[model samples]
Target chain A: MTKQDTRPRPKAGPAEPDRPQRRKAAAAYPYAFYLPAGIVYVVIFLIPTVMAFYFSLTRWTLFDSTFVGLENFADFFAEQNLSIGFRNTLVYAVLTSGLKVVLGMLLGVLLTSRLRLRGFLRSVVFFPVLVSTVAVGITFSVLLKPDTGLVDRALALVGVSGHDWLGDATTALLSVALVDVWKGVGLATVIYIAGILSIPPDYYQAVEVDGGTAWHRFRHVTLPLSRPATYSVIILSFIGGLRSFDLIWTMTRGGPGFTSDVIASIIYKQYQAGFYGLSTAGNVMLFLVVSAIVIPLSWFLGRREIA
Target chain B: MRTFRRVTAEVVALVVAGVVFLIPFSFMLLTAVKDSVQAAELDFSWPTSWPIVANIAEVVSARDYVLLRAYLNTTVLTVGSVAITVVFAAMAAFVLQRRAGRIGALANFLVLSGLIIPPAIVPTIWLLQALGLFKTMPGLILVEVAFGLSFAVLLFRAFIAGIPRELDEAAMIDGCTGLSLFFRVIFPLLRPVTITVILTMSVTVFNDFVNPLYFLPGDENATVQVTLYNFQSQYSTEWNLLFMDIVLITIPPLLAFVFFNRKIVAGMTAGAVKG
Candidate 1:
């Protein structure tokens, strides 16, 4: 009459009669399997990250060094473009991620709405994600020219004037961020599309039963249910915007006087100027900035999942 | 289900996509064929005469065929890093999922950090110089693999979790040893996820611009993206040639998307869509 009598017998091959036999079986999946990847990841990614902190305090060429304490950090903060880079990084991340969330959700809803050309539209949107960022950046730089570019020409046809988009400090960062949205919003859209498609139909049916219109369905069902997708889009795009380099580099070169200079671009400029310690310091600052913004943001977004 | 709204949405999406996506590519094609003067204008106009062949020659021959060399270098970097990533990530993922311990948890954190944390580029270059790997293709390839590993490992780990534990036991009972158990039995079952990892990693490593720009400097190791960037200043006013370079370098990714469209979407959206 014991509870053990109700249990089914375990299969012979996997069922262990002794602890020793189970241990032996576990040996088949060795811990050594982690070594190869661990070696490469540590040597190439993690070690350098640890070394960045040490090297940032030293005025050294790659080969030789003399410790300079906090000079590099002070110089980095005082650098003419550093503040702009910091401001631009946050602005770029916010602007890009915001646009991506709104636009991606809308497009996601559109694509999942049982449209005729869903497949075609999805392909068209996501294809840009595969294109070269440098190529796209350059193309947009050309397109954003004041008078002769296609963007301005089209705007003129619509009775709107086009300004010097990339040449002006005021518009340069905004312009680059917009182009980024164009290239990247595809990724966000796909994520959103997947999230929307995975939603259970029962909720929508419940809305219908309650005489919910499309707007009501979206507001009540889709909006609340798609929080996971929204979270993913914001985090991924925000991080991407923070680390952004090639697009800004190719488009503006942090130019028109560093208005569009992001942290990554700032680091590159320091390195290019032979300020090795300063560049390494900039790298540390970027890491800190990314962590400060992202860690809290992700925690805030993720806390609701537990409930 | 609503045909009217669907059609309207479809038309609007089409127009927006056409203008945003289509016109720029069309401009690239058009500009690539135009004479230098018209190309420099950077306007949307039919070429008075299609100097497509000359443009191609000038672009391909520019800087003593640097673009062709870039294509070769990019292929090596992409293929090399992607292959290493698939094997290493799959192996590591296999262990990470099967073994539940502090080691596994720590490893998982590091892998995840690789995704969130930006690389310290200057320190990395210094380390590479110290190790005699700077300005070398192998160095850059390893860098790419390191960066690509985290995502691949996570994807493979997720996929691996779905694979039953019984498979490992069955194989082990058949006298399969440690590595062989993973390679012969577990690895083959990973084809679907493997393909996904391969496609996405290839696209990422191939289209990468900054890594090669920073790590693998010098014309000897110019990647496709670097070649395009270099062509920018070199051919500043040569719009036809510049666009030609852009067109040339864009093909591999374009071809990949065209053929493996579904797989790419599934692989990319796999993480974001899942809770």
Candidate 2:
């Protein structure tokens, strides 16, 4: 670790002993530092967000757009698979986020044990996260291909019939959710590692001194201290699930009759089908849906942080 | 003894965990090597003959070598996007962290919101069209930079915060100009975090499927992930070729993680842990 000298930077102006104007300006230096990022945020993100709402009311292709006044949204709702996509998005978000946090923490604790080859194990666990989403989806697409997949072969070893995981409407969404959990659990583990490491070992020692069991220590000390990590995992994973496209697109393309079509995939399908106005509406709905969930959650989390 | 039991339990747990993680990668590797029949069977067995060369040839030669073209496009996109993101983000973060006020607070919130909100794609397309940047590499590059800058700025802001303001002042005292103050005085000290930003940004831009799929449409500008469509038709998907495509696409980011995983983790966790 590099040792940092914590000296404050010397001011530019001559030894003018603490003028309010200079102090104000100097104190505002940080904002000056932040300006370029501010421009980027406004232009790229905020502008787009504001325009999405505006355009969602309009019927438009790439170049020419006209004010249609919520007709697009109505069309989106009126569409056959839209409702299903909406339901799938919510369910996928909840399941993937819930599983990721639980599995991530468990895996994190297991990996952090006083085991051999700890570094190697950590790397292994995190490897999936580094793979491209499309690649993971493609790999699993083959691996879960009912008849010839490795998973089916493994099932056959136990005298069980294997079914098409991605092609089956019943299993497709859940299968994607599981693969998401598999890929993303590493991130949650990373968070947990940082969280766990930060907790003073003395807490564990004190618990032990009090005749507390391992489970007891974990329940009272480890879990509470790791709340921040849990919160992070939930929020990040939920948002990811809501916006997930690549994996689902590659695997089944929301196939077997739109069984696994999350909102994002539905929107992409609209784009693919050349329903430009409808797809744009779907995009708006996705933004709105994510915002509706995330904002309140962020506020609640922020309040919790304050508490 | 209790100690012996604890150690044994820990070892067993570790081995089980390792197997869970390792098996998938093993599956990927074996699938890449196996012939069509072996692949379809999902046989965990060793390949009778290494079809690695043949598979690579097929994937590369598919769709007029679009996958190879996609790889080149990805490289260009990643490099261009990262360079823009790092430079612009560092500059932005420098100012934001240095200057403090209501404006700063508002700017900070906007950037944070960028981190949370899913981008509205349709409007973005319209905006691009209005700007006449649609279906262009530079347009996609700009879009990538725009999205990427928020996270980079956040990282850079936190890292820059730790650097005392004294250095900026001292440099100013020595008659350094605006650009010099940043380039010569402050920028050099940002090596660790800059490397983190670069590594993370590069991986993200390279692995990105959506942005390129949307912004850089057409075979001429198609990126690696989008090019995987070559293996898929209306009816059937070429599993062997698709897996090979997977191998190719997965390699760069995997290698990146192998080298810079620590930095990437540290960078990501910096704000949360430190706060």
Best of the candidates, TM-score: 1
lDDT to native, each model: 0.89, 0.79
Residue A40 error for model 2, in Å? 4.3
lDDT tens digits by residue: candidate 2, A1-307: 2575567767757655545655544543533555555565666667988877777777667677788888987776787677788889999999999998898898778767676777887887787887788778867776788867777877898999989888888999898888888888888888888988888999999999999988988899989888888778777777788998888888788878987888898877877786677787788888888989988886787678669
Q: In model 2, what lDDT does residue A156 have?
A: 90
Candidate 1 regions with alpha-carbon error over 4 angstroms:
A1-22, B1-6
RMSD of each: 5.0, 5.9
Candidate 2 ranges beyond 4 A from true positions: A1-40, B1-4, B7-15, B232-238
For model 2, the DockQ equals 0.54
> Which clashing pairs does model 1 show?
none
The local lDDT score (0 to 100) that residue B62 gets in candidate 2 is: 74
List model 1 lDDT by residue over B1-275, tens digit each: 67887787779888998888888889988888889998888889889988888888888887888888999999999999999999999999998998767788999899879989999998899888888999999999999999999999989999999999988888888999789998999999999999999999999998899999899999988999988898889888888989988998888989999999888988888877664
Number of the predicted model whose lDDT against the real structure is largest: 1
